[model samples]
Target: MKKVSRGQRKQTKRFSLHSNSFKQVVKELSKTLVSGLVVAVASNFLLQFFQNQFNFEVAWLFMTEWHIELFILGIGVLMMLYIWFTSLIGNRYIGAFLIILISIILGISTQQKMLLREEPMYPSDFSMITNLPFLVKMMSNTIFLIVLILLIAISVSIFWLIKRARKGKKEKKSQHQKEVRGLRIGLFVLSSLSLIYIYAFNSPGNLVKAAYNDHAYWIPYSQEMNYYNNGFVGGFLYNLNVTPMEKPEKYSTEKMNQLLLKYEEKAKKINETRSKSLKDTNVIYVMSESFSDPTKLIDVKVSKDPMPILRQRMEKNKSGEILSEGYGGGTANIEFEALTGLSMEPFASNLSTPYTQIPSLMNHFPSAVSYFKDAGYSATAIHPYNTSMYKRKQVYQELGFDTFLDEKTMTYADTLEESPYISDHSAYQEVLLKLEETDETDFVHLVTMQNHMPYTDFYPETTFTAEGTADDLEAANYFQGLSYSDKALNQFLEELTTQEEKSIVVFWGDHLPSFYGEEVVTVNGKVAMHQTPLLIFSSEKEKQESLGTISPIYFMNHVLELANSPVSPYYAFLMTLEANLPAFEKGMYIETGEQESKLEREELSSETQQLLEEYDLLQYDITIGNRHAETANFFSSK
Candidate 1:
């Protein structure tokens, strides 16, 4: 080879330096891109899995405009930020570990909320969660691991390719410039495509940058026209196929009032049939959490009967599955039903709490309180938790209670239960003490919280067996809490029976215990709504009147009639497709009477939905202030 000229040698050295710098920059870029891609892929896959697994679509359908948008944006933003930060802080192994841990915690929390966030008796799909169990769990873990490894490898290889490309830079300068421009264009195109997607599919009414989301049948249409339509905007898309397929149900006010009147008559007839004079019977309503029908011998059984004390009283009391208007949670909604006796519409997102939203009804509480006051019963309400948690203090006082006692005043300083908390047993004791302390014969409402969630490690005084069969330590703890409450109740009743004053204890559960955290169990190819027991226990000497299988809405009315309180009128909707010519179950309504009208759960038969919907109205206002008064009395008399 000829000796290289000085100029050529200098040019080659310069080229080499430039090539090395380019390689370094490209390597760094490749690593950053790879990390981001891995995070995005993993997050999207996990999100899709969870959404499909839990029927989040139905939830989105039910959510209010604000909630829908808030939830989507909140979840998406939080998740993206978490992944983005994690990628910046750690290597693949650490990131993977964090992802798994966070996913599990998130899964549990979401599962709890999902389980409780629907109409009661929504059928579950046990097959999906239970089919292969250990295998599925193991496979999922493996898949994630494999994907993580593949991503790391891809990222490293891309970095190496950049190094090789840089070595050939001098000869390929013109070609390299062309490739760089093409890559930049491709990235821009991809970003534009993503923007189009977000705009098209995002829930309407939410500002894009302010960020929020929902889904109707129109999702496909919205997605297709995202470049222009931007979703439903004040009837601009009314002609679009994306509009809700289910038409807005319309009922004439006259027709609704007439229907309500009919139900009122039916309620009167129920009281007549029971023959338990509701005239002046003191009512005790006990709303237990996760108080399932399993406590009874007639239904399922736990290894050890958690609610033994209550079980003993079940035979004598007029009780059965109250067929709750809610499933895993929505305690307030159920409380609304027990109080108002109104039919709950499925499509109505504004049905959470009538007392909070419907001011007209809320404003009437003073009248209810005064009405009982005139009838010689002072109204008081008691809750075994922070009174302010649910705004119960203001609401209770507004509803006419002479006094409102919450966890703070009701719990004694020396109680075994501990600060910021009181057990159901302790709550019952407080109730009794209040009744004894009060000079007036009064109506009391009690809300208990000892049986509330994270049920496993919550009780300081009680230790659950962490061993076999009781895998449901959480549920077991909940029931144990309930049992303790029952024991307190039994003792209280014994004392009340000795008193000369006659009273009727109208106690029922506020809502079923939240089984949202429990793993879904499939028995005999069917999904079951864990049953809850509602009882109208009495200490008065009137003939023991027992009405069979009545809805919770009827429980108050039945008691009111027995005590001779004049009841407000109501109507039943009973339009479910399962029943022929719209049938009423007991004294309740069915917005959809058809068999398939189940609480949007597809696992159960359609007829089940009809039966479930019949009692759905108890989630609404039907019986005015009777429940509030009754609940107050139950707490005071405890």
Candidate 2:
């Protein structure tokens, strides 16, 4: 052994060097893989924690429940992103920096969305990318600062690691270079495989959905619970499996025509009973943002009644709660349903704002305003807020509104003492101007923004407070806002009575305020969680029978019936559906007097079941299917 030549000694040293280089490369790759796993878990927890209203108990459930398949899928996604970034930048630490940066943004958005929307962020939500600046404002300063600190810390640490790695000596033509290149190439290949396995282009055997089906528990109706049961990455991937609109299996032009023919006859019979017409009456829909009474909420105590005028009106007209599609936000969806008489429960569960989605696709979108516009009424939309809030400018144009008066264009732009938003009284002034400008029959769609979020110390007269809430000051402010809105409505209605023109004011709250904690859900029932006040006030008409709790899709039908105004065959069809089922919203179906929110299809009568099927068919025909129903004059008022 001691008789080795100098050449053999050199060869032995070279072999040892190569082996050491190989071990270093293997170690680096192993470390990278482990890092990806850790980030995946941490990111997933962050997302779930925020989505679940920052409840650590729910976040820890994932760790205890062994959501192994979802965790594996999440790891795959992060590794794929990491590998791509590392390969493109030629720096593993830089790749990590970018990955963490994206994770922070995504986590914050998910949290904010959960707070404002009472649901998880859908893939469709990102389509409203133009509203990013406004959407970002929804995040509280506390949350923003915490996220900023974490992000800056992560970025600096990674930058320092990158600089340190660059300072180390690396040979150009050494075994170390080859080893490094080989490891990166290997990781790149693995990431590619991971992406393909997780998603396979609409394949039923897709791993992302398959994992959810096998391991994760999810509800088709409740999106928030879906995010809770499945982790963030897992829930998002599961939602991705949804279609924008599934064409009904039995959908055909001939079938749509037959249903239209049947509904036309029913409309004729219904119209014969109506006394008055839409000749001189003005149809006005006032959507008060977050206008619900705080006293109705569990554990919320108000010093005095905030909505006396609304309560009085509710008792004297077709009034009750409206089952909202969203809990905390989604004003556009409620407005769309009220205007179009279309139920979102039947539409794909994942569809975002139909104001943008529906109008973008259809050339002939017949809405309540469209019908009124067709019948010699001037359609006017007034909102004392930014026109671009929900893409309302485009949507109002699509709805064939004649005059669109927003915050910038409105006559009255007065703000409350402490609030930055325009007052409801100012919003009502714009409507009065429209009425005075033209004596012709009018349809005004007014959305008020006075009661919008960030309700902190709004009014000096504020006397409302909550004992059990984490934030009593906020609750007090929100209740005070409702009182102000009530006063505005009272004054507006009195002014309407003084005017010569006969008008019908339909007022509703979009949804509950987002400040309510999860404890509210535990105290208040789920069905009650979605309830908001609804009233139809006619200048001349006296008290009518209560409409009871109903979905917004039935809103126009009830309005028409109350006004004794003739309705289109489409409205007649919706009225029939509403009769069978008074409220079907967001996934919960509530019978008029029933407290049981979840009603199974099996519990329905055969006739009601069949009518529901036909309802779905007709909606599909009008919205997603060819213009079979619309062309057949299914919406033409007799």
Candidate 3:
């Protein structure tokens, strides 16, 4: 409205230009900050989803609290990457898109790994990504839908960012601005290195200690607990470089030779006193899933002894408690010990499932199957579940199983109404079929799935209900399933009694059911949870014997003793160890004159220590180290 002067008009135009530039700068900074924050939040959500799958309340809360710290770290890293990438590429949108894309992919992959394995992502698991299609098939439709939505959202976000970035005008930067950018990046890198060092090597406080510890003992024995106590990211990174088995002290080829010589001499002495051969016997092992005497639980009473026949047979026959390496889960570990004559106790605690980790790597593992195969026995593995679950199909082949019959190949015709798993009766039928089909002696390992967990309506009408517990449906359901298992076992043994061919049946519960609370394990008593009934029946011999308490690793040795089967040097060593440390699993063991207690190699008797060290070294050589097994024919039957 005032009289227009050239100088005043010029000043007003400059002010307007400066105001618009300030707004533009604010908008660009907002885009960068918002994009970084979005990526960070998405990563946190993905990790939370993984935690939720575990269904650990404490872990969920811990992750919820720890995610804030992770978010902050993620934001800082993304911000630095954004600046550096933009500087390098001169395209802010491309840099942002890459950061988002990589973060999304990694987060999704981590989630998938955790969901499938029930453990955080490890470097070893990267090799299993080829099974992604199978994994996707196993996942629920909900997961696929959510994953699709996530991909779409990310694509849309990338498109918006690209549009905004392309619309931005490029300008020559001043030297001062360039110098400032370089200084910021340098400071950022230094800060990042410092944080990484602290995270990896230092225990600053309780929170940091939980997240990471330099101590070797903090390795993931209980993966769920590790992830719960440590944040997901912390646990995952810590396990990335974990050695599967630490070399035993004083381990060398010379030391190994000396140990083998000592054991071989001992074995020779033992073999001199024996005259036994498994030449004509068909050996059958049924590692029943979640099979245990539930009546052992405190304050629990069922309508009938779920395993009356098994209980009666155990009382009269060669039977005892098997101290399992795992509780509720880890069936493969139990099977591994039984078949390989290697106690898992000596390996890294985090090496939970050997089938997934160790056996898959080798072309031929020293196992009961291999030993039997060498003895002219055809070995067959039968499991009524997906062949790909735990990668058992491949593992069986590596373990020298001539044939693997999984769910797809099984002739099992019936399944329980309440459960998707094949009935135990049907599984036994398949075992009998295999026995009849084989003209030569056979070694059949049948891993049943009828009694597997999530005992949710595993039985349509609960015939055997728990009376003492207040509305414990899970216990009732578990008891009913066990009753069915007992009936199936009785039927199978009865049928076996009719067969004329001499055979040895080794029946054992892999681990206890996870129906009751986890606290029930330690609270009721150690024996109730850790001990499962193990019975070895001989069709030709009627004599009854008792093995007080033993580990699953000694199962085949006991079978050989009962059947007078020829023994390998490794198994001979196992037999001797079993006589001394009769019950030894992961944590607890029973000494010759003492009750079951937590034991360390250092606390063991000198003789026991020497034996365990030799055992550890032998197992490490065969499983993790350069196997020198063929030099001594360690697995060959004498």
Candidate 4:
């Protein structure tokens, strides 16, 4: 006020400019951070909404849960870190783009998982992306359009945000630039470590375990329940960790030695008493897709018995119920149990498919193919579908198959009239060709694809319709498909019977078809939806004996037993286990003299418990444990 110099006035102006610049920077940061957090929250709500099938009550329940709030908070922290990191690099737009893109992908996956009742997308699922061209055909127009819109919107938003950020003038270098850089680096490292710890170990007192007690801990058994109990994000993070298989109680080299010795002694006795041999017989295993008889379903009535031939053959052949580990899907797990003679019940629940997780981890998998190869038979697998589906091409190679015939390679792969999948008739024709091509006794593993799911209006005309019930399109479509499968089965059997070569045809349904509604098949107060029909037939017309209900783990063992074929000590151990315990699937075991009682493993007798312990130890050693498998003849033909 007394005398203003030009220099002082210039200094005062500079201070004012600096203060405004700081305020503008703060405002921009706040806007970007808040927008990112909003996007994260909205995406989570959308995921829950879709996953719960737009059921407001279930969606609300998920949102109201305390654990879900923590999950949201975790997602927010991740978004904030991404935004902050991108902002530091002068490209906050990329962070926004990534957020939107990931949200879209997760949303679609959640919807699919809900529909399929399958586990969330794993690293292995990405290998199936090659089948997207065919898979996309199965999607509805509405879903396809919605996804398209989402992608377009995301692209526009990303472009707009990037343009806006670029339009803003860059801030001048600050006096504490080094400090800001150091802080940003420190925050990034800290956030990364926190995320890794949370996802890797389920930290913060193991929230997943706290939410779900011991019973619901296995995610693959009931993934839907897991998601409902734990929030989507929480459940996903919990399942991300693939824990090492726990060693059987008191497992050791000496313990394994004792079990091997006991089994070796039993094997010696069985081999000495063996009467028949499967040396020259061609073994054909047909895992028909969704080939269960709907007439066995209780709630709904069909117009006629869809599987008349199978029912008639059941009386004259060695046919029975197979307690499949999967329902509707999970063919790979069912095949794994059949091929390896190893029950998935003992492995980690998250190890959903061994073909994807186990075979890749192990140097060699001692499978039925390897066993047959050792016994002087060429093993070949045939699937009338994409070889890349479930990574089967790689799996078959590792499993030691001499040849694998897939959709691309199969000569007789022709689609059915009302279905996109290859017909069982055509698949059986390929089986005949393989039999003709190979002079040696071949182990032919055929997985049919005629009756795969999506029981929609694919059939222009329906031959069979649901009777004694309201009109249901899904049921009618399913029945028609089942009818086709039955006819194919009859034709295949006729061809097999006429063949001059002595062959054993093991036919079984992989699992029941997933119906649209809640009307599931049940038997004796227990859900029989997981059970499928199995038939073991011989072209030579051997004595037909009903095997009753059996677990898939004992499938190949029974095949060997019925053939009176020589088996290794490992198989002898399986025979003993199967003889003692009634056939059962995971989460339920049939007790020693109780055909109907389904009890937990803990409820078994002391002797049965010891046998189970030995089984678990041997399986662990052969699969997840050290290379002690070769130390004994557990997987050898000794």
Candidate 5:
């Protein structure tokens, strides 16, 4: 052994110190990276599980090529965040627990919503935090228990981690801690920048979107499919849609005025042929909740017809179907379309529920209530359910409803057997009461709650049986509810006939009921899945004509036409739209009676396409763009 000099001894110690510091950094980074990898991977899986059937194989089929990259981005973000949070707390275990707990909570919520609504959660949904208590009441006890158990488990885990971390905690005398501090600071900054960049813009050229251009599917008609194609993180980020869409290319005041002028002339031409008017009749619209035709929408082979009266009327009366804006849920959106004569499809993909999402953005509120009120009718809106849902009270008040009645204020707030909602019989009876109260012509819009989700055995006894693995318990229960609704409607019609005033009851199913698997819906066909029964019956006998297929956007137009009612220019445009495009849902599916109902606008006549584009322009102006039509006499009195 050679005797070492003082300088060499110092150098040896310095080298060892640097090497140990490097090892410490590597060790900490490796642990973070591994934990992040597990979290990100598990989160993506949870997202897929939420959107798809819980079956792994089914989820696997929906994964896109961009999934891997999405996970990479998610992992990077999580790891960087873990590193920074751990450094700040000086405890890796606690930080890890916090991250895991938050991610798991989000997953639980997304999964619950997906299972119930068949729609992915959006950031806009968080704004509904104020209604958390009421929403909890709406959830099934099983889901609530699952959430409770998860929270308890996480609490126990966090407690254990805290105790363990505390036991190992020590006062540290630093050995050149500057480099480690520098490393953490860099990570924190990098993480912050990365997050800001990813979330800042929803433009096509955003870094994340550009990188996954191969699978950048923004115009997803089905938001569930959007999540299926995009990984959880990517899909969630997609819902951070600050901009609804780029402004229309020709969205100028002059252009809008010109379009309105053309429609105004069309309205005059339509008015020339009309003899009677909606002004003279009491227009009652019943937007039956989840009141879909299962026999058609799902092709459910039942022991008996669920809605025989509706079917009979469908064959004889001016009845067919309207493309529902929602499936399983989105009753409000369907109502919004029918009430306002605006299509949901024209709005951005993220404006899934316009009643909640887009209403706040509107400076002018126009609906059937406005048109009816203009015609000197007492416009009353009724929903025998939560007043806070979709913020209906505020929306209705703004829409100029003379009276808005919810469950809290309803005269008959009775519920059927085992059902949480008000029964269709009681709901119709409430409408009958409204009709009797007022001698003046009325415009009554009733959104019944008799057929909402969690469709178990609502009816005590039913003869209906459906074809399914579990004998289609949900479908059977739904069919039974429909039977009850059918009886209620028949009774209501009889009651309407007894009334002295001439009246027209426009009844339609908001959307299909929940419980059907996505696979079943897909096999049945998207257009078929979305089409719900639309019946326009009157108090007195009238000519029955098949109106073919149509959408809720054109619903009021049909109502006006069937009633021989005068039309506003806006109604005239919608009438033209229905003529060109008989049925439309989210702009993805269109049914022209001549052609087999197609899923796209690929093979349309040029004139039809132009009309549809004009419809988009009008809808965009109403919801997102300027109120050009408000000034151009588009909604002028007939």
Candidate 6:
């Protein structure tokens, strides 16, 4: 071989260096170009889907609006960049390839989510659509479209990769192209600048503050397209599940002293005349589902006894028409009302239970577990359904229960048929078992579900005694369910009486059963929902007159009185309402008596709106979390 010259050797070295550098540049360019395009396509598809699904104002509405979508896109972009960085670090093209694969999977998942009935991709609810027969057919079409798009994306990604590799090989001998390189860098910078601009100036409030401080600041974006998506943030997420302190400024202890004195005098009179030593009692609260007194029920003739058991309980036990605050159906609201003696009427609207929308109220309750627990009772709760159904597990535990038994650990004599719910008799069996197990020092809280319906359908034939009108039949079906529940109670009572020591069994229906169809409207009056059967049955049947006649809120005070437990100071009771609603009578009585005090103290007293908002915030805190409750703090200073 001929010996090479020094200049030739130097030229060879330069060529080798240039070749390697060019290859590296080409590889990075190819990876970014391919990955960026894939992400943009996926993002654009999401944008287009949202636009068709919702009327968004921005061009890339998915990225600009809908916080969830934005989060997804942000995560996608970050992943893509991460892939690009990793590729550079490892000196291999694997990062870009992995990103492309993940993008396709995510894109498919997003599209699939839109088609599912459970929480559609868009904020706009398609839940009503699920009721439609055509929904399944429509979803099939969506599936086909998503599948096609995914295939196309995959094919395009593969084609682009192959094209880049081919081009890189062909340009192996060429000098690095400076103009093309500059253009790529310029495009990257422009894209980044656009993202920042859109994020900053596109919405309301201080963007920086929302980004850093607002717990649900993303909500504005989440609902940028669908306005109804803007629900109470204090609900189910931010508010601490505590009862709110009533607006302290509204009523003063000095003003409330007048009422406290009256109560003191009344207690003195009752104590001086009435016997202070009360018998150990079993207070059975029968809570009928969706129960309301229908004027038509009084008029109509039916074949069966709808409320035979309840009627029997009412006649035999101390019963009254307890005015409940709800319509159609909201069980937890009534439960909250009954347990805390907090009237839900002041806060009632589309916003039903604080558990779902407000968690703050969980802690702000004017009455609490301590009240019952302090009264020489170990409170045990039983529900024959999923423990977490409606978040009951947490709510009940937080409210103060020594033992909470749901469907998970519940015993059943008969298997549940048709639905996941247990039979009424089986539920009662569990109640009886609990009653047997509890020490004499414990109290039982039972939430029954057998009466939940398809109204006429769920009523057991044996419980139904063919007797009144169609209204009677409805009542009868309710009674039949109640009768079955009553049988369970009778068994529980019989067992309880045999015990050497006594315990209180407080069993009440969560709400009246909700009837569907137009026929229901024709029968029940508009306000029929408020009329529910509230029966308090004690183990030892004393003259019924001894049972207190009062609202649910007052039940707490009375429970304290019955068990002879210590009552909170009147000031603490007043302050507690700051977080929860006191009964209508109590709130009104206080407001009425403090009229002069209210006029004297404007800033010190809570306005009607402020009280309602505070209550709402408290409810939100219990169900949601603390962040949501703080939103209502806007009114705190005012």
Residue 389 displacement in candidate 1 (angstroms): 2.3
Clashing pairs in 2: none
Q: Residues 268-344, candidate 4: write the lDDT tens digits.
A: 88878666666678889999887786666667678878888888888887888788877657788888888877787
lDDT of each: 0.46, 0.78, 0.71, 0.72, 0.74, 0.46
- Better structure of 4 and 6 per lDDT: 4
Work out the TM-score per prediction: 0.54, 0.87, 0.76, 0.87, 0.85, 0.51
| Candidate 6, residue 87: lDDT | 35
Global CA lDDT computed for model 6: 0.46
Candidate 2 regions exceeding 4 Å error are 1-38, 52-64, 115-117, 127-137, 168-207, 249-254, 356-359, 362-365, 592-596
Q: In lDDT terms, how accurate is model 4? A: 0.72
Ranking by lDDT: 2, 5, 4, 3, 6, 1
| Candidate 6 weakest lDDT stretch, 10 residues | 231-240
lDDT by residue (19-105, candidate 6, tens digit) is: 876776777667666665655455444434443333334334434565444344344444445344443444223444444454444
- Per-residue lDDT value at 522 in model 6: 45
Tens-place lDDT per residue, model 1, 1-638, is 89999999999988986786577547644764665456544543343333334455543442334234333443443334434444444343344445544443333333333434432111112112333332133233444465457557655765665576567556535524544444445544554554444444324553443342233222221222221122212111222212111221332344334444555555455435443333344555567655564434222345565566666676676555554555555565566545543333331331234444343455343233444565677677777666544456666766667888875676542233432246666766766776777676766777666555545545555543322222356555555566666676778778778776666676666455544333333331111343356556667644344443334445545555445544433221221222232212212332333432223333345665544443332222223422322332211111
> Per-residue lDDT of 1-638 in model 2, one digit per residue for the tens?
57999999999999999889979987877877777677666766666667766788877776556576666666667777787677666677787778777777777787888766677777656656787766656668898889879988997898888788768767567558777887788777777776666655235667556655778776766777777776787767765534546777777777877888898999999989987778788989998998886778778666788888788877877788888877788888888888887777777755666765555743465588878877799999998877776678888887788889988999899999899889999999889888998868999999999998888767766667666665778878888888889999999999999988888888999898888787886699777878899988888776667877888877778778767888888888888888878887755777545668755655666776787788778777777678777777777785
- lDDT tens string, model 5, 452-516? 76676676576777884223886788888889999999899888888788888899888877677
Q: Give the number of colliding residue pairs in candidate 3.
A: 0
Error of 3 at 280 (Å): 0.7
Cα displacement (Å) at residue 146, model 2: 1.4
